[model samples]
Target: MSTSIRVIEAVKSVNVQGSPAHWANEQGTRFKNPWTSWREHDWRDMYYILFKHNRLTPKAPENMSTLLPTRKPTWNHEGDDAQKLKATWIGHASFFVELPARANTEGRVPKRGARILFDPIFSTHCAPIKLAGTARITPPACALEELPEVDAVVISHNHYDHLDRPTLTKLAALPRKPHFFAPLGNLAQLMSVGVPQDNCHVLDWWQSRRVEVDIPSQDGSDKTVPAVFDLTCTPNQHGEGRTPMDRMGYPKSLWASWVAREVLPDLSSTSPKTVYFAGDTGYRAVLDEQNEDEGPVCEAFKQIGEKFGPIDLALLPIGAYAPRRFMSTVHCSPKDSALVFKDIKAKRAIAMHWGAFILTTEPIMEPPKKLKEACEEVGIEEGAFICTDIGQTMLYD
Candidate 1:
C-alpha cells in the first residue's frame, strides 16, 4: 500500500499508536464528583448559581427512550425536485443530504445529486463497552448496503461514535470510495481503514476546499455545478477515543463542526447558502460571547458566519447530557441549545444526539422534552426547532 500523505492546513499530525492510556484509572478517574467535602448551603449555592432563572422541572425519570413512540427505519431515493435541500436522518449523527440537481428539462425526478453524509457511524455499537456497555438502543437507520451512493463523508472527531473503524472499512470497499474529510491527527485512523490517501482531506480550523459537482440539467446537457464547499475545522470542547488503553483525548484529534457553503456560479456572491454541522459540544458561557474572548469556539463560529452569513440549516446536538456536573462542561443542555441557536443566528435548527444511543444515564427522551420546554421559555415558535425521531427526513427550500 502506498503511504503518501497530503497536508491541508495548520492542523497538527498524530501517530496511529494502538496503546491504551489511563482512561478509567481509579486515582485519575474524573467521573466521581467532588461533593465529598461540600456542606448543605454549598449545594444550594451552586444550584442557584448555575440554574438560577431557568430551573428544570420534574427531574428526568430512568428509562427515557421508552417514553417516546418508537419509529422504524426507512430508506428511499424518492424526493421532489425544486432546487431544494433534503436531509434524511440515519440515526445518531449520520445524514443523507440530497442537494438540488440542475433543472432537469424532461421534468423527471432529480437524479442523484451530491450525497453528503455527516459523522457517518455505521457500527453496531458506538460506545466503549461494546457488548458490555453503552450498547446502541436503536440500530443505524440504514445499513451500509441500504445507503445511496455517497459523494463525500465528513467526520467530526475520532470518538468511537463519530468515527467507527469497522464502518469506515466497509465504506471504503464501495465501488467508488467516498471522499473523507476530518480534523488534524485523524488521517492516520482513516489510513488504517484502507481509505486511499489521496481521497482524504485533512483540514485546519479555518481552511476550505472547492469541489466540482456535475448536476444533470433538464436541457439534455450537463451543467457544471461548481459548489465551493469550505470545510473548516471549527472548534468543539470534547475528547476522543474508543478504549481505555487508547484514550486520544481532546486537542489530540481536534473536534470540530463543519461548514459547507455553496457559492453561486456568479462571482458577485461568495456563498449563497451555508449549512452548519455543529458537532458534539458542551455548554460554555463563551457560546453566548458577543466578543472574541469566547476563545476558539466563538472565533470559529463567527468566522463561518462572516464567510457564509445567515446559516440556512443547522444540525445541532441536543442529547446525552446528564449528571450535569460532568456533562455540562462538555455537552450542551436544551437551554444551552437555545442559546447556541441565537448565537449562530441560524434560520432553522434540527436537534440530534438523543433517542438513538445510550451514551449517558440521562433518560433517552429527556433531551427533546427539555428542548421543548426551553423553546417555550424563550418564546421560539413551533417548527423553529425540530426534534424528530430516527428515519425522519426534512426538506429545506
Candidate 2:
C-alpha cells in the first residue's frame, strides 16, 4: 500500500548526478515521483470518486476565444539578431520559442535562431482518439503548418494530453524532422508514430544533450551553420499512464519537466539564454485545507533554481485543479503555480495549461483571476507572472 500523508515517507532531497543514473527503481521497470512526499488518494480511493463522487463539469464562457483571441504570429526567421528571443503560445502547455541566434554567425548563413517547440499538440483534440476526447476549447494560435522550421521538440511526458501521436506523426514527416526528447521509457511512444529511432532522445532525470539544427540560408544557398543548444530532463511531481488499465499497472514510463539553454560560440557574459518548461507539476498535495503550504511540498523546484537561477522565461501550468484532492498530485492550482514562479526564481513567467480545454470543475476564467490574487498574496512583483491569450506572442530582448 502507498504511504498515507499522515505518515512520512521522508523523501530525501536529490542533487544533480549527471546521468547514467537510471530511475527505474520500482522493480527496475516502473518509475515513481521523487519529489512528491505523499499522494492523498490511491487507486481504491479513486475508484470511489469515479463511481460515487459527483463529477462537476465546468461551464466555459460563450465568448472564450473572443475574450482570449488568438493572434497570428509574425515571426522573423532570419536568425540575424543574436540578442532577440521570442515565445508564442500555442494553447495549453504548447509553446514555440526562438533562442537568440547562434553567436557570431549572423551573415554567413540564414541562421534563424535555434527554434524549439515545447509540448506541442496542435490537433483539435488532446487524446488517443480523433473523434472524441477533450476537444480543443480554443483554436491553436496558429496551425502547425504555419510554424517555422523547428530544431527540437521537447516533451514533458507520455500522457495523451502532452504527447499526441497524430501531431507527432505529422511533425516527423516534415522535410527536416526535428529531434524529439522525452523522459525514459518513452522512446517507443515516439517510435510508434513513425519517428525514426535516430531522431528520438529519451533521458533520465538530470541527463543533458546538445542538439543542433542547420539553419536555412538567406538566398536558399547550400552553405549554412547549425544552431546549438542543450536540453536537460528535469524532475517534477507527476504521474503517468493513458488508459485506466495502464494506470493500474505500474511497471510504466517516466514523466518530467525540461530545461533548455542555448550554446553560443561566444562565451560572453550574455551569450547563453535559459528557458524552463514546467510542463505539468504540483507544488504540494494541498492536504491542509486551512493552509495548503503546510503540506508536504515538492523540493525539485528549489534544486532547479539553484542550478539555473533567474530563468529568462518559464512556461508554467496554471489550471485544471478544481477538486484538489485528486488533481493536486499531477496538476497545479493557480496559487500553487504562483509558488512555483518564486521557487524557480523565474525572471518572467507565462501561465499555461488552461483556457485551451475545460478539464476540471473550476470556472474557465478562474485560473487567471486567482493567479493574480495568489501573486499579490505572495509579494510577487507586478507583471512578473502574467497570463497571455491562447495564441499571443511575446518577445524578449
Candidate 3:
C-alpha cells in the first residue's frame, strides 16, 4: 500500500474521527484534563516567576564545568545476551533505546536490534532562534553524528526543547531516513523542515501504529523473523506552543506521552517489553479535593497501567517545576513525577528532563534528591527509581 494509504488505514484502525482541524476545535474538543483545571499564566504571574522569585535562578555547581565532561559512559549497541534491553540517556528528555530483535539462530550478523530515539535535541540551545533562548547548561550525552542509525524517531510535542528544528533537519538528512512519529498536527512542522511526508506518521491520543523490523538470528542461522514494534500516543497533562506568539495554535497540535512494545512473532503469546515515555506533564487534579484518586488524569494513568503494565521502564520528567503557583498547570515537580511513577506501576523508571537546562528556578540537582525522598515516603525501592548521569547507559532486563 502507498504511504498515504497506510497512514489512513492506521488512523482507521484506531477508530479516530473528525478532520485534523476538528481535532483541535475548542467548541468540541475531545482532549480533556479532568483532574486539574487549566488556567493560563498571565503577565503578572510570569513577571513574578521571572523576577520576584529569587530562588528560581540556577546555581551552577563550583565544579560544573569540570564534571560535565566526566559523566560519559561507553555506549554498548549490543545488549546483554539475556535481558536484551539497553537504554542510553542522551541528556534531558532524549534517549537512545535498543530493544532486542527476534532471537536469530542462523547468524546473518544479527541485524542490530530496533533502535528508537525519543525527542532528540542535539543543538546548543533549545529554542526557535539558535542565538537566543534556553542554552544547554550541560552538553548532550552523545553527539548527533555519533548516534547509531535509528529505526524510528518519536516526538512528543512542538516545544522547542522537545521538538527541535536543527535536530530534525539532521535526521532528515540521514541516509537511512528513520520514520518519524509525532502527535496530530505536528506533521506540518516536520515537513516544513524538509522531512518527507511519506516518512512522517501522525497519531492522536490513545492511537497506535505498528512498524515491522527484521533481525538476524542469534545462533548463526541465516534465518530471520520480523519483530513488531507498536507505538501508541497516550495522554499527558501539558500544553503545546513552540513560542509565546503561537499560543492560539496550541490545541491545533497535540501533546502526549508514549508507550512502546516489542513483540516477536514466535513469542506473540508471551508478554512484551513495554516502555513508557512521559513527554511532559503536571499532576494537578490527579488527587481530588478529598484527596481521593478520582481525577481524569489519574484515571487515565490507571487505565494505562491496566492496559499496558507492568511497564518494564518509564522515562519521566522530574524538573522545571518551581514556583508552583505559576508552573503547576504545565510542569510536574519531582514529587509529582514520583506519583506518576507509582500511578503507572512501572517496574523501573529513570528520571529525565532536568540537569541539562536551567528552565526554572529549582537547583539543578534538586530533582533527583526530591524524587528519592518522595519515592522513600511512598515505599518505592531505592534503585527502582534511578537517576543516571548524562551519558550513562543502563541495561534493563
Candidate 4:
C-alpha cells in the first residue's frame, strides 16, 4: 500500500505510520501539547490531580430531563433556500448543522440542503465500553432515530469521548449513509466499523475538499441547482488515542478544528457564511525549548483568523479545564474560548463541550457562567457568546 503523508501550513509534513505509528511533524516528532510534559512524573501528577482534585461525581442525577426544549428538527435537504442556516447542539462536541442551498422559486418545495454532523456521539456512555467507562451525566438532546438524514459527518479525532464506536456504527447503518471526514489515520477505524471506504474522506490540517449538493426549486419544478461548500481540516491544540494498547499514540489520526464555508459560483458576490468548529483545544503557549517566545496555540488561531476568518459562527469548547495544571494543556476554559472567539473574529459564538458530562472539577454550569464573565471582560456584547440547551436549535440567517 502507498504511504499517507500530509503537509500542513507549508511548515510540517505528517506521515501515517500504521497502528503503532502516529502522524508527526516534519522532523518525525509527534504533535506536542503546549504547557504539558508527558513524562513519567507528568503522568503521575495527572493521576494524583485526577483523584485528589477532580470531582468525578455529578451534582445532580443524570436522569433529570433537560430544561431546554426539544424539537423535531426540520431539515432543508436540497439547496433551495440560500438564506437559512441552522445548528442544534446534541451534547458535548456534537452539533447538527443545516446549510441552505440557493433558493429555487420554480419548485413547490425548497431543494434539499446539506446536513452535516460534527463529532457526533450518541452512545449512552462516552467511554471505551458502556459498562466500564464514563457514563453520560445527561441524556442526548435527540435520539438517533430523530436525527435528520445527514450528508456528511466530521470527526475531530479518535479519542473515545469524541469517536464513539456505537454511534459510528449506527450512523454507518443508516439508509442514506453520510460521508465521513476524518484526519489521516482515522479511515481505518471507520472502515473497521463497517463504514464503506468510499464514504470516507481523510484530510490533514490545511487540506480542503469541496462537496456539492443538489437543490431543487420551490415551485416543484424539475430545475435543480448545485450548491458547493468547502470543508477544511484546521488545527487544534490537542492529542488523540482510543486506548493504551500500543504507545500513547498522541498524534495518531490527528485532532483538529474544522472550517466550512460556502463557495458561491459568482465571484463578484460577497463571501458566503463561514463556520468554525473548534473540536477541542487549549489556549496556551506552545512551549519551545528552543524558542520560548513562540506560542503555538495562540499563533495558530491568529493565523486561522487571518487566513479563512471573519467567521460567522464559532462553536468553541468551554469546559473540562479545571485544575489548570492538568487540563489546560488539552482543554480550554471559558475564558480561553472567549479569546478564541476574538482571535477568529467570529460574529457570534456558542459554548459547547460542557453541561453534558462531568469530566472535570468545575460545577456543571460553571462554564456558561465563566463564559459570560469572560465575554464581558473582553467588551463583547451581552449576547455575542451564547450557550444553548442540549436540544435547542439556533437559526442564523
lDDT per residue as tens, model 1, 74-93: 33344454457667777777
Tens-digit per-residue lDDT, 247-345, candidate 2: 664537788899888767664466478899998887777542547766678888888888887888889999988677777878999888888878888
Runs off by more than 4 Å, candidate 3: 1-37, 42-44, 49-55, 65-70, 77-79, 104-109, 130-133, 216-224, 266-270, 285-298
lDDT of 3 by residue, 264-329 (tens): 556345467899999977766322133423433334566577778889999999998876666666
Candidate 4, residues 1-397, lDDT tens digits: the string is 1111121233222222223222456643355433232222276555766577534544644444553334555554334234567788898899988775554333233354567799999887877666532777667877888886777789988887788888999999987677888877788899988899878888767778777666455566565555567888877777776666534643555778998887665542545888899998877732214342234344567757877778988899999886565676678888888888988888888888986666777766678889999999878899988998777777776
How much does each candidate deviate from the true structure in C-alpha RMSD?
Answer: 9.5, 8.0, 4.6, 6.6
Q: Where is model 1 poorest over a 10-residue stretch in terms of lDDT?
A: 31-40
Q: Number of the top candidate by lDDT?
A: 2
Worst 10 residues of 4 by lDDT: 1-10
TM-score (all chains, Cα) for each model: 0.74, 0.89, 0.85, 0.83
Error of 2 at 119 (Å): 1.1
Better of 1 and 3 by lDDT: 3
Most accurate candidate by TM-score: 2
What order do you get sorting by TM-score, best first? 2, 3, 4, 1
Query: What are the lDDT figures for the candidates, one per model?
Result: 0.62, 0.77, 0.73, 0.71
lDDT agreement of model 2 with the native: 0.77
Write down the TM-score for model 3: 0.85
Q: What lDDT, from 0 to 1, does candidate 1 have? A: 0.62
